[model samples]
Target: MRKWLFWLILPLMVGCQLGAPDQNAPLPILGEFEVVNGDTIYHTIRDFSFINQDSQEVNNQTFAGKAYVVDFFFISCPTICPKVKKQMLRLYERFKDEDKLVLLSHTIDTEHDTIPRLKKFATDLGVGLPQWQFVTGVKDSIYGIANDYFSIAQEDPNAPGGFDHSGRLILVDPQRRVRAFCDGTDPKSVDQFMEDVERLLGEMK
Candidate 1:
């Protein structure tokens, strides 16, 4: 009877071990990303180059090996740009120490936001070295990257000084794939945004 009991217990323990998750395997990169009809949205960003606030050439691979948040804004904008920049400032304060996370802000008004202008904006916003990048480039290049990578809306009207865009932050993974997005104007969305970031980073570790 003791032998039969031991055999039964042995099988139960083996079954439990088999059902557990593998500790050595990496976790899935996406746990909260929205899937449409069981298909993940794989994005291909357009290749481009721009000058950052520090006058460094930033390109497609600038975000490699890290998860960075991106947004588009012009320093002269009187409306949502200030609010968005302030909110992004808060975000930078939270993750500034984490070398794996960074922030990139591209200017939509390339004609005016030159390297010096971008540098001044960064200084006014208190952006630190290697932590934040304010980028500007040819008018069409900046606009193209905004639409392609972030899926944000942007239209340049023929009217003088006329342009429209959406206020949204894009989260991109180390592989240049868009992972998540959030409305920059909404404070609640920032909370949810960080939650997803944590989830994604945890998977990579």
Candidate 2:
């Protein structure tokens, strides 16, 4: 969908509360964007390979049959990222043990967020193991992949921390299609998104 159309539909589709009738609402499948039989087609998260905080290679195959949440950030970000991380912490604490769920926090500043830095960042967050991962890798590839997920991460001299990026937490289903997203800077929205997460997990089962 076009960017303007996306924002128009997003609000209407999100905010599903667990106890409400809309709790069972289906998540939207993002980006119908491919060419097949002389026509356009929908798209999904394409293949990618990057290094996680653990220094292990992570790719689409790594998340096969699993649903995951993703966000872009840099450790030294002076604005927005910390707030986003705070909410991400809430998610990590709650769903860390869910067998089918995982969180991929990718850094926009890949040049500076090395394995050691990400490892320390993960430590500082008090989340780890099979649940959460702070990833950093080739800058261009990371930026391009972020766009593929319908998120943004690019350098900006005028922006704080020298980077401009979206503060949205994206949800992807087992099939690698974007299911939902929320403003990571808002705690209330994250709370509602938490409910959506639970509902999605239950739906997948």
Candidate 3:
């Protein structure tokens, strides 16, 4: 009787695990992680470079071995930028001490947001590089790289900032793969994102 009961309970426990989501599972590799409706093919963030607020050149190498949150915004955006940035600051405060985390804000108004302008904007925000970097580049390069992250940024004659962009904070893993994202314009969503961030970092550990 005891042996029969043990066998029955063992199968039940094994089934539970086989059907359960792995709590420590790394985030899904974004930007084309599959093919043929099943074939696996993970994608990664492509290489690119831009000038940060301090006029330093930044590239994909800057994120080597680190997971960072990225977003697109024009310093002068009159709509979602402010709300998104507010959430970004909250993220910064929460993860600032985590050495593996960083924040990258790319300016979509490339024509007007020069290195100097980016510098001033960083000053206005009361933050600076390494932990948080504000980057600017040629209009086309910035616009193109934004899409590589599965986000959008492009000029629109009718848009508020002269550019239409997504207000999303993208989470990239140490491998350069986009792992997660959240609505930057929503605080509650960011709170949930903060939880995801913790989970992703745990995978790294």
* lDDT assessment of candidate 1: 0.70
Q: By lDDT, is 1 or 2 better?
A: 2
What ranking emerges by lDDT with the best candidate at the front?
2, 3, 1
* Residues 93-172, model 2: lDDT tens digits: 89988989999999999878889999999988888867987788789989998977778899999999999999999889
Instruction: Compare candidates 1 and 2 on TM-score and give the better one.
Output: 2
For every candidate in turn, the CA RMSD to the true structure comes to 14.2, 3.0, 11.0
Please state the error at residue 28 of candidate 2 in Å: 2.5
Instruction: List model 3 lDDT by residue over 1-205, tens digit each.
Output: 2334634564353234234335677555555554557876676778889999998989988988999999999988999999998999899888888889999999988878888998988788877778899998888988988876767899998988688999988899988887777778978778767877888899888
Clashing pairs in 3: none
* Shift in Å, residue 94, candidate 1: 0.7
Residue 59 of candidate 2: its Cα lDDT? 91
Query: lDDT of all the models against the reference?
Result: 0.70, 0.84, 0.81
Q: Report the Cα lDDT for residue 200, model 2.
A: 79
Error of 1 at 81 (Å): 0.9
Give the distance in Å from residue 40's predicted Cα in candidate 2 to where it truly belongs. 10
